[model samples]
Target: MPKTLIVVYADGAAHPGDIAVGLASWARCVFVTEPADHTRAMEPLLSQFGPVITTGSAAEAAARLRPYVPDGLVTYSERALRFAAEVASALELPFHDRPTVGRLTDKWLQRDALRAAGVDTVRCHRIATENDWARAVADTGLPAVLKPAHGGGSRNTFLVTDVGEGLELVRGLLSEERPGLVAGGALVLEEYLPGRDLGPFGDYVSVESIVRQGQVTDIAVTGKFPMVPPFRETGRFWPSPLEYEEEERARELARRSVEALGVRSGLTHTEIKLTPDGPRLIEVNGRLGGGINELSVRALGLNLIELAGRTALGEAVPTPDFYRGRAYFQLFHPAPRRASTLLGIEGVEEVKRNAGVTLYRPYAKAGARLPGGVQTQELDIVMGEAPDVTELATIAKEVEATLRYRFAFADEPGAAVTESSVTGAELGAL
Candidate 1:
């Protein structure tokens, strides 16, 4: 008889597809999901492993799982981390406590904890009203970032270069009837670390690791492509192009950041910025790097989802080993435009013919209306690998030139349709 693993499934949960396959080989996996999520796409994938329990609230979900006596409780949903923590506590399963999860999930709390631990981080202030906004500008100065204290995916985040711009952006953000993901509609205004000198690789990289019994192991460093203005992530490449010294420095910062947040057992993703002086903390996540898990598994030859589950079960896990190669993941978005309809994509077949191309998923369908932000409007992603960086660059260029996205806007006088060719430089920032 195998041990049972309980998973909390929701919109932001670890990629359900990957988790389902990964856990099936290790344990009797049970999924606790909302009634809305137990639909056609998820139900069939999850049902293959074990029972799929549907409940409306966290309490109900926990009650349903109590009988299973799960050996581990896990979730990758940012919104469900606290709920999962509570359920794990009730089940006597391994997980971070609510307070620790709070520190990891909330940007303001995360910065406070890191700073108190003597880890380098930027000065930040909480803003909930007009008065709070004024104080933040006065305190943090111009060229700062204002974002939801509890947000993810760069949604509703703004970079204000002056007081007037900050005020205007905050006013608009506050006026929204429903600001999604901004807890209590509060904002965190923090000093901006100018990343101009980091060169084409950008000024930031994310450290991916797994923690067990308060011990952290550095797995890999992922290099980021330049973000669209105001901090929207466009793409990422791994293993980081940074030299050995810089990689070690960022890894150390990540370890300190995770330890300060009191993460005991699970996967951790820490984002750090390399300023002229040294590495500084940007944010820390209490879950696996979203969407990067697939790339990591292919490049590093490690099953992170399995590692996360095994760690929660108190099993001793081995340090990860990597194979030689370079891989990149880039998300395509319709930028500098609003409310456009996706018409079609071209050369997808040609891009797929390349041996180096591993995954090319297009989410935007013909007649689909795209929203305004990077979080909502990303239309597709291209992932691939090659023997080395030079070969990888060539592969990326071929894919970028081969695929074309077509769009149209109804508001235009003639409903003009447009075709944009994606370039490797734009996709990988090479």
Candidate 2:
């Protein structure tokens, strides 16, 4: 008999469509969602996976799902982890303890935990007022990063070169005139981990691991495209091109990091930066990493969504086949910092026709107003496969060359970047 699992779904790494497809054969998944503006409309589509349980709160959700007696519960969204934990505990199913979930969700607490466990030493302080600047800098030093203590997807994150700029940025973030989507409704100032330049690729890599009953199985080390300014991620690829020793070191640190956070089960995505000294911890994600499932399925022939679901249900699953099957990639086109209205975009047909380009997804239609952040303000994404990273670079370039955007800058009246100029992250700075 198929196990019945309750999935607390929301915005995050896992795409609802892919989860729906993955759950069709493995289990009877009842997707529980809150009554929120962003998710209310997706109920129809979510129901395709199984029954849709709509509740206004986590308590209500657990109450409603009690009669069903689901065998397990899972959540892909960091925002919904706490909710899922609550529901799972109510139903006597497996899930992370509240303190572990707190460390996973809160950046300040995670850093503190890593430091306590001797896995990390980066100093971090939560910022509640301007007075904390001196103390923050005293601990973290110059070139610090200001981000939400409980944020992900690099939302409302900034790098400050001086104290004046840091204060100004924080004021802007909290002010009524320019409040933005900040994770956890607060800020964290911490030391920035600089990386050795590995030209053509970002210095960061993530470890994909599946832990079962205190055993950590390290999978592939995922590579990245050099970020656009202000910490905007451009792209990510599977089968990271890290040197043999470095990859092993990364996997070891990831294992230690998760164990330090008391992660004994489920999937983990640990981000690490390749500094001159060694790989440093960049925050561990409790759920699937963004764009991981897409590239993993295409390149490695793995369906992580189903695998994760089954693992949560205590079903035995296969260890990942990490052979270098192929190189899969997703390069995002982020809107320029000042672009407000998307006037026009050129080369959609050309990009789709580009060599090795398998899919071209354009999110913003012409004339749509853009908020101009790192992740959410993305204009489009181009994905494809190559034999290796070296050859994948050529294919990615061809796809990039075909994309061009014309946008009206709201701050600068009548100013627009046309098809003739540089596109993506090259045209602007954070």
Model 2 lDDT per residue over 124-227, tens place: 98777667778888888889888877777777788889988888887766553323233226678989999998877899999998888878887678999888
Top-lDDT candidate index = 2
User: How far does residue 429 in candidate 1 sit from its true spot (Å)?
Assistant: 13
Candidate 1's C-alpha runs over 4 A off are 34-45, 177-183, 197-200, 322-337, 410-430
Question: Candidate 2, 74: how far from true, in Å?
Answer: 0.6
lDDT of 1: 0.75
TM-score to true structure, per model: 0.89, 0.93
lDDT of each: 0.75, 0.80
Per-residue lDDT tens digits of candidate 1, residues 267-325? 99899988787788899999988766776777766778888888878889787563325
